[model samples]
Target: MTNRSEAGWNFDNSYAWLPKTFYSSLNPTPVSKPKLIIFNEKLAESLGLNGRNLQSEEGTEIFAGNRLPDGAVPLAQAYAGHQFGHFAMLGDGRAILLGEQITPDGKRVDIQLKGSGRTPYSRGGDGRAALGPMLREYIISESMQALGIPTTRSLAVVTTGEDIIRETLLPGAVLTRTASSHLRVATFQYAANWGTDEDVRTLADYTINRHYPDIEENENRYLSLLEEVIKRQASLIAKWQLVGFIHGVMNTDNMAISGETIDYGPCAFMDTYDPATVFSSIDRQGRYAYGNQPYIGGWNLARFAETLLPLLHEDEKKAIGIAEDALAGYNEQFQSYWLAGMRAKLGLLNEEKEDETLIADLFKMMHAYQADYTNTFRALTFEDYEDTALFGSKEFTQWHEQWQARRGKQEKSNELSHQVMQSSNPAVIPRNHRVEEALKAAVEEGDFSVMEKLLQVLAKPFAHTPDQEEYCELPEPSKTPYRTFCGT
Candidate 1:
């Protein structure tokens, strides 16, 4: 076997230096057989890794957990989270953080092995992952990154020469995930609930250095960290809404403190514009519906703030006051971000008092007609004569006229406005049916051609490629009411 040390993984894991209770040290369980499925060439280059080596057999064994790279320190991080408002202690059940690799650009990023094996936190369940879910994360996370949203990235996928039992017997797989850091709000909650005040303070300081370095010198660094996290989440959720994404599970554990979209289980984008749309089968109450994401974000931030109350101030009453003030600003911050995104989607370069009403009116028309969310915005870039047929109704005609009048008030020319709208609205998304079709081919038929084509098309989501026009079409009626699962 080739030495992974020669593979150029410059591991420098700072998190491992923290208290032993923060995580459990362990190596990944060896798999029966290791086979490389996919390798992200571009991401590998960015990390200063040799692409050729990663595609070799040695890389397959390392990625599949049969071997460890030199300088690697594997551990399962400990955390506690509020899953759907109920707090519980949880940790890395099926994933192992190999270590942080310092890139050529001097950026430290975590490299994790998802579905490597059972850990101390497995909770009486097998820690193996099915091939379908591993591929699902690969497709969705890469799509999110291409859409210009902050998200955890998929580095590689390796097949295990064994079967895992899910709802039925399925092929096993492992995913190599890359991120700035895997720390979440639950990390703090875990420390607060189990460790002393010094432990919480230490974590806060470490997080501030890693994520919010600008606030490190501030007297109220803890409060500043809270606000910074809240702001990032506000902007992140706005991006999700603009793109019609439903996170399915917005649990506190799933919310990343870095503001990037992390877990992709049961997540989907809307084909039609419905504010109350939900895709996750487990989301029975619609608490995490499309329109409720902003609220859920605020709720999760509040939980994070609660963990920092001790560090916010020495006086309990004063600490509570500081946290409350920060929490109270979440809605206004969210609204500011959401409104700005809506303005861009509507092609309004200069905002006016009536912009909100104008945007709301268009959404109302779309809801009334059950319009395809993506297509409706994309069609606006075409000439009225060519696009009017897409929306044939007196109400739509009136709305169109009002929109034109509003556009006339802009300082920029009509062509420039159209350009802005085209950039803001994507011509295609990973439609639920298309994603399922690709997954089915890969899982049942061992055909990866469909998945490859879908990935290529999603890479340039804003462009309207002639050959990929069919991918932009909405799903048929038979595919309506689609429900996604967590794939556990």
Candidate 2:
């Protein structure tokens, strides 16, 4: 009922000052009632919010978009996207950005209310979110941050006390999320295709100033901006590969300009080391499988580069050439990052000419043996991989000898190699079954303890503590391959 000035929300409302076409100003359609489900205390404090003040009904309502804090200006952004490879005009259908907050570190970050309500781009869909999906985002996103991956974060999830009709009457909820900025590849795409050339230049300049400030004075700032984004995305995808995280839906719009992992929709960490592993129910073609992530990352970035052609050079041909030259290096850049990362995982201190072959052969064997990805790496790091069943086979026995021989050539001692491996591999991930178990408990049984414990375990992914042992083990095999829905 009252503004949350006491909650320490210092809103700057800068994005709202953009041209009207960039967004549409609106208030969230009020929910019947809002009940707080979870609050991220550490993130709240980091953003300079008074955590105690945000734990009340008033706080819950603020996230639910039923209450406004001081300096708040809610709007749904306008953008176009390539969804499953088809271009479409789209915008924020169920999410509302409530101004950028100036954090204690003096960083400007977007605070968005997802599942807030419908806007101009609702497209006849109910702009409400279900409780299960909201909680799923909270668990996975927070886990990503803990694992040192750049990502948008979930601050709170609040129940709307109303049913969101999907296949069934599921309870509605709202997720208060935060990110460096919500600028996506689709944002640039929209400006390029629909808005004037001036619009594209304006957005490119704004993005450089905000995300790549050092590049602001570069001779070719726009081209330099593209190069920086390409580098960032290359490294980010490499990290995702090392950890076996699959972003099931990677529509260009889902690709954030800040290079953070955005949208947790239908995403999952792989249980086994199969490159073809996929969990998204909608991604039947496997275009975005675990193994194809790097290629898809390149594909999405190419789409982004197209949006910047006008800003890259004056002559259309020269622009194409500049973009082509820049885009051409994506594979090399991605390979450089991925190779370096894989080397760390295998505890290889010094690179060898056959390093790529060594890693490729390992993956081939893993695919053949169905070895658990995270567990195998963790066991190797801890020196217990020899006890695993995968090592019982003759093929694995020979491979182990080769790996041992490779390690013998390392400049550092075995202890240092193991240390590097420990940091490179995670002892735990948000297992799909465990995540479902927590969601089922919270949404069906009204229990939060399961999720809370899982979060605690995930917070220290490399800790290797006894509490993480259970999570380190994979869930019992199910006859059906796991399927995840967008749950929008």
Candidate 3:
């Protein structure tokens, strides 16, 4: 064996540099009889790792939390947040950061093992993840990455060979997650809540340097960073809507400071159109529903703005003024991004002021008729004046007429625009009912074929596959499942 100091990590290290009170310096609780269940070969290679090695004993040992690798600085991160509108301090309760890995492409990504075990922040609860949730996260997160959404990717998943008791007994598991960094808005709030202004400023500056470097040259660097984050959040949500994704939980702490989507808890994709759609059972109030995502995002950002008040300006009045101005940009940014996404969904090219009216009218009709969001868009892929059977309603025809009327003014052809819309609108999504069906089969029986099939279909969401038209159809009225749950 190589000397500890001389041995290469196959990964690098970068601490959060947080104050002692911000986090508990705890290493992962080693697991017994750890066995690798899944490893993301493509993601491993993207990070300049050996895919073969990842499938080997050494990789399995490290990934399963059975052995801490060289250069590993395992520590649980800390942060505070508003959970379901109530303030609560939370941290990496069941997760420990292994360190950072600089890819061959020169991108720095965090290597974290989640559900490894309890830490100081466990807060009187067991810090273990069930096998079903671990598998669901792996399937859904990788699907999100394949869909081109900015998200945290799953690197590996391992079965802990130990049982955990929940409502009933269940198998235990751990997930290795990768991202730019795990810092969240809640991270800064933790410092502001318990620590001094100095810690807030340090975090704000470090975040700006790491994620929003271009803002550093600006005069109001902190304000600039806030504005940039607002824009990113807006665009991110817009993209989610475009692809029929629902985050399910949009709590302040879950909002990543890196502006990447995190925490796949109870998350799902829309199968039918409904603005008030909510799948997460914990979200009984429907706060983080499909249409309410943008609003919830704004609320989360407001919390972040509150934490940065001390750094906004010297005078209390001036600080509020600065923050108000920055926060106000969220609505405009969200509108612009949302409109662009809607336009792409409908296959509109020219920027006519009337485009908004046409899109709004379609949504009104959709809401009125209880239409299927994914199917409506997928129907547009086969746009033929002769083939009216593909469209479900006269309302779609009316909307199409309005869209064509506007398109008549553009320099593009109907065929060209249709092709563009087809590409923008996906043919398949991880349907809520289907995902549930898959999970049920996996949990009740040891069958994962259904889940594997769904994964394969979603891996190329834009493509039309033969003998898979069943996957594209909407869920039956009676079969419509609602109220998903946070596995924890």
Top lDDT model: 2
Best-matching candidate per TM-score: 2
- Model 1 lowest lDDT segment of ten: 381-390
- Tens-digit lDDT string for candidate 3 (92-161): 8888998888777777788999888898888976888887888888888888877778899898888788
TM-score-superior candidate, 2 or 3 = 2
lDDT (Cα atoms) of all candidates against the true structure? 0.88, 0.92, 0.81
Off by over 4 Å in 1: 383-390
Q: Please give the RMSD to the true structure for each candidate, in Å.
A: 1.5, 1.0, 2.5
**Model 2, C-alpha of 443: deviation from truth (Å):** 0.8
| Residue-wise C-alpha lDDT for candidate 1, range 360-452, written one tens digit per residue | 888888887788888888787554334323467887778778877888888998778878887888888899989999999998998989999
> After aligning candidate 2 to the native by TM-score, how far in Å is the CA of 271 from where it should be?
0.6
- Per-prediction TM-score, please? 0.97, 0.99, 0.94
Candidate 3: residue pairs that collide: 279-484
